[model samples]
Target: MGIGDKRKSDAERQERRRQRLAVDGIKPMTVHFPDQDRSIVRDLSRRVLDGQSIRQVMRELGGSNQPDGNVVPPEVLAELDYVKARLVAIEREAASQLAEIEEAERQRRTLEAERDVARVAEAEERAKVHTTATEAQAATRAAQEAKERTTEALQRAEKAETAIRRARSLPGVRGRLVRWLAGDVLPD
Candidate 1:
């Protein structure tokens, strides 16, 4: 679709070619057998050139006996190992950060729970104080009412004593007459 895309496609194509070549156990250099003898070959790509024993070019065309030839190069293996190490480091760092976050969250929850407990305690204390104050107010009001009633009863007793004294000093009708007027003696 674009220039960058074309370059990407080209790079992908080359990578695929390299992988295919690796799978086929094709190497840049190989060893060849020339005239019933083995000889080292530098390039395996040339099919037309035939040199005897003097390091001829030959393709080993690998089999199960030479499994190392099917693997990637040592440099590629080293690079993959480096990438894996970096990824492992990143994962460990992420795990540490996650642990810190979880610890902080736990602390926050603990604080919230403590705060809730404190709030409940405060509310309970306030209610208790309010109830105590109400009880005290009721007791004070009852005491005031009792004092008023006692004063009224004392006044009535004083008035009854004054009436009895007045009736006693009156004349010879001291017993029944004083009692009847004071309502202490019932009239028949």
Candidate 2:
């Protein structure tokens, strides 16, 4: 056959398959296996081509899915849920539903309370850290001030010692007073 004729035939075959599958109520699926398992997959494919039942083979291989081969569409399932809720409302007491709502509200309030407690704890911890940092800064300032005072005291002592050395050659009282004030600076 020509390429156009082959294409037409293939399209006709797929359309026929779709109608058959719809009638049979079976879904089609595609599976891919690793190249290393090519031989095993080929054997399964050959069995399916030779008219072996795929579902039967799956059952024999320990699968528990014994479906009735019918699939309910998602739209139908959603409609069923709506109808079920309506039926329950018509048959049950309004107070029962009210109780359920109250329980949900209580759960929401409990969660909010927990979050509030966590926020409070976080704030307290942050305040504590800030206070500690402030105290550390105050301590650093105090140490710097103490070092500056010690340096000034050392400078004054050096000046007094210089004066005492200069006056050591004085004849009498001045020399003695300088020596006494300096103490260890000039020997007797």
Superposed by TM-score, candidate 1 places the C-alpha of residue 129 at a distance from the truth, in angstroms, of: 1.1
> What pairs collide in candidate 2?
none
Residue pair clashes in candidate 1: none
Cα lDDT of all candidates, in order? 0.73, 0.79
State model 2's lDDT. 0.79
TM-score of each: 0.51, 0.44
RMSD to true structure for each model, in Å: 15.6, 21.3
- Model 2 vs. true fold: TM: 0.44
Q: Write the per-residue lDDT of candidate 2 for residues 42-107, one digit (tens) a residue.
A: 776666656678765555444546743566778988999999998888668677878899999999
What is the Cα root-mean-square deviation between model 1 and the actual structure? 15.6
